[model samples]
Structure formats: structure tokens, C-alpha cells
Target: MQQLNVIGLDQQGAEKLGKKLNKLLASYQIFYMNVRGFHWNIRGERFFELHVKFEETYNDLLLKIDEIAERILTLGQQPQHTYSNYLDNSSVEEAANIHDGRECVESILNSYQSVIRLQREILSAAAEIEDEGTASLMGDYITEQEKTAWMLTSYLK
Candidate 1:
């Protein structure tokens, strides 16, 4: 017989989801730091605009990071808290010295692509196990990220 967690999700399936969420969490942490760098190091004529945008993006990423960590806790797993773990598990690259506005935007776009792809995978896995909480979380993230990606892409053109 399959055991269930406090939230009524199958213990085994929730563990799988927790592992996936840890990877996503790692990616967000790296992306958040990258955006922080972009926010601080950005230069050129568009500095003011890009700085504000980067700050907003990083702030939003921070919120998602907390939410993801809490979800992992809810799933009966501990969130990986070390930078080494984040570096080892993350799919998102840690961008550095990206001072140019266009370069920063491009980096952000690339990170979004990686994150959104992973989110879609999680969404599918969650659906397979009838985990609406995880599915809804991923769905909301993907939708918001898609819109942000479009806007960033438009800025590049």
C-alpha cells in the first residue's frame, strides 16, 4: 500500500516532486544572483531602465525561491541550502560581469528558457500523480515567465 503525506499526496510521488523542485530551486537561486549582478553592474545609456528592471526581476525570483522551498518542505523533503549544492544541481548558468544592457537581457532570456522548460516538465510530472498544488504552481510560473520573456525579447529587437 502507498503511504501518503500530511497533504494527502503519495509519499513516494511527493518525494519525486520534491527532488524536481529542489533542482528548480537551485536554478532560481543561481538566476537570482545573476540578476543581482546585472542589476549592480549594468552600464551604458540604458543603465537606469535596465537596473530597475533587473531589481524587479530579482525581487520576483526571490519570492519564487521562498515559495519553492516551502513547497519542498510541504512535500516532506528538506530544501538544499548550500551554494555548492545549487551550483551542482542548477541548470541555469551563473552569469558574471554582464555589464551591457543588451547582454543582460539576453542572459535573462536564456535563463528563462531553461527555467520554463524545467517547469513544464514538473507540471507534467505533477499532473501524472494528480498533484494539483505542484501543477498549479508550475502553471502560474510558466504563464508569468512567458509574458516576461516576450517583453524581454521585444526589448532586444
Candidate 2:
């Protein structure tokens, strides 16, 4: 579905950005799911606290995912969500059941940092192409991811 309002960005550039953004989106979705998974199954000393906090954090991540995916679709491309598709494109790796809270925190922190990096790159490319819509989207995702990384890491500190 075309967003109706098109920018002066080159078509090729827009497509490139769309691909990168979708890849990041897939990674983010998988990461958020992992967060929620642990949130539900989490047990240990900090069970109650970690459980509640993890759910809240994952909720916020979910919202960000929606916004980011919308931005990609608005750029005249579909957001890819299939596992195989993500496996092929996402720079971030999916979480295996090989981690506890400490490890989870580390994994999520790395995921957020990686996402922020990817979003930054996408923003630069979008701006260079004059795609204000995508650039703005990338800006929003970057800020949100940064905050999320902070919150997730705070559990360790």
C-alpha cells in the first residue's frame, strides 16, 4: 500500500532503506518476543521484580516495533515478519534458550545496541535520499531503542 504522499527520494534509495529497516524490524520483533518469554518463565531471587519490569519493557518494545514497521510500509514496502525472511536479513541473532536473567540482559543490551546502529545507518541513508518520512521513523526508533537498552541494562547495574 502506497502511503499516498511520496517524497522526492530516489526509488532505489527508498527500496534500500526499506530493506534495511525491515531487517531491523524483524530482529526487534524476535528480541521483544524473547523478552516476553523470559518475563513469563523468569524465576529466581528477583522473580517478581524482574518479571514485572520485563513485561513492561517488552510492552514498550512492542509499541516501537509497530511504529517502525509502519514507517517501513509507509515508505512503499511491506515489513517482512516471516522467520525465514528475518533469519536471512536481520543482523541481530535470535535468542536461544541458553540464558538466564543476567545473560538475557546482556543479550537484549547487545540487541538494542545493534538495532540502534542499524537505525542510525538507515536514517543517514534515508536523509541522503531526501526521505524525510523514513528519516523521522529512524530517529524515533533510535531514541526508543536507546532508552530500552538503558532500562534493560539497569537490571545488571
Candidate 3:
């Protein structure tokens, strides 16, 4: 008998997607903290603008983190929640003491690249399994993050 998850995705494919989503969730956690640090520790001429932008970025990450966790649950897998787990699983490294706005934005852009790449992979996996829910989520994230990367790149230029 073929097993399907709650959303009718094949269990094996859903499990693979869940694992990838968990990794993404971990990256998002680290990236969220990094953005919070940027919001709090940002210095120099663009302080006012970058500070608010970082806050908005982190807030958006927070929402995505929740959505990712819930998606994992919907896939019939547990979402990893511990900091240790996130640190171990995440590709994005922690950014510490980034006082300069350019450096912070660059770090953000780099992290977005990592996330966007992983999300693209997940999108492929979801598409293979006909998982429209996960595919749609990744599509939305990729589009938004790509625009953000472009804007940040422009800021640096």
C-alpha cells in the first residue's frame, strides 16, 4: 500500500521535503538572529534607515520560521526547535558585532543567496512530488528574497 501524508504527497517525498524544510528553518533561525543583531548594532550614516530595515527583515523571517515549522508538521515530521540543532543544521553562519551598514547588508545578501539556493532545491523536490503547497511557499520566498538581494546589491554599489 502506498502511503501518503496529510496533504496527499507521497510519504517518502514528503519526508525528504520535510528534512529540507527543517534545514531551511534552521537557516532562517540563524539569519533571523543575525538580522536582529544588525538592527540593534548597526552604526554609521545609514543607521536610521538600515536599523528599521533590519527590524523589518527579522520580523518577516520570524513569520517564515513559523510557517516553515508548520509546514513540516503538515508533512508529518517534527520541526527542529533547539538552538543547538539549528546551529548544526543551518548553512548560514552567525553574524556578530556588525556595526557597519554595508557589511551588514552584504552579510544579509550572502545569507539570502544561501537560502534562495536551498529553497530552489526544495522547490525542485516539491515539484517532483507534485507538492504544490511547499512549491508555492518556496516560490514566494525566492521571489521576495531575490528582490531583496537586488536592492541590497544596489545599496552597496
What's the TM-score of each model vs. the native? 0.98, 0.85, 0.98
Candidate 3: C-alpha lDDT: 0.95
Query: What would the per-residue lDDT of candidate 2 be over residues 1-157, giving only the tens digit for each residue?
Result: 3322365456677788888888878878877877887787776777777778778879987987898788877777789878888778777787777336777678778888888888889888888878887788778778877887787777679
Per-residue CA lDDT of candidate 3, range 1-157, in tens? 8798777889998998999999999999999999999999999999999989999999999999999999999999999999999999998999998899999999999999999999999999999999999999999999999999999999899
Top TM-score prediction, candidate number: 1
Winner by TM-score between candidate 3 and candidate 2: 3
Report lDDT per candidate: 0.96, 0.78, 0.95
TM-score of candidate 1 on Cα atoms, chains taken together:
0.98
Candidate 1 C-alpha lDDT tens digits along 1-157: 9899999999999999999999999999999999999999999999999999999999999999999999999888999999999999999999988798999999999999999999999999999888999999999999999999999999999
- Pick by lDDT: 1 or 3, better one: 1
- At residue 28, candidate 3 shows an lDDT of 99
Which regions of candidate 1 fall more than 4 Å away from where they truly are? Answer: none
Error of 3 at 52 (Å): 0.7
lDDT ranking of the models: 1, 3, 2
* Stronger candidate by lDDT (1 vs 2): 1
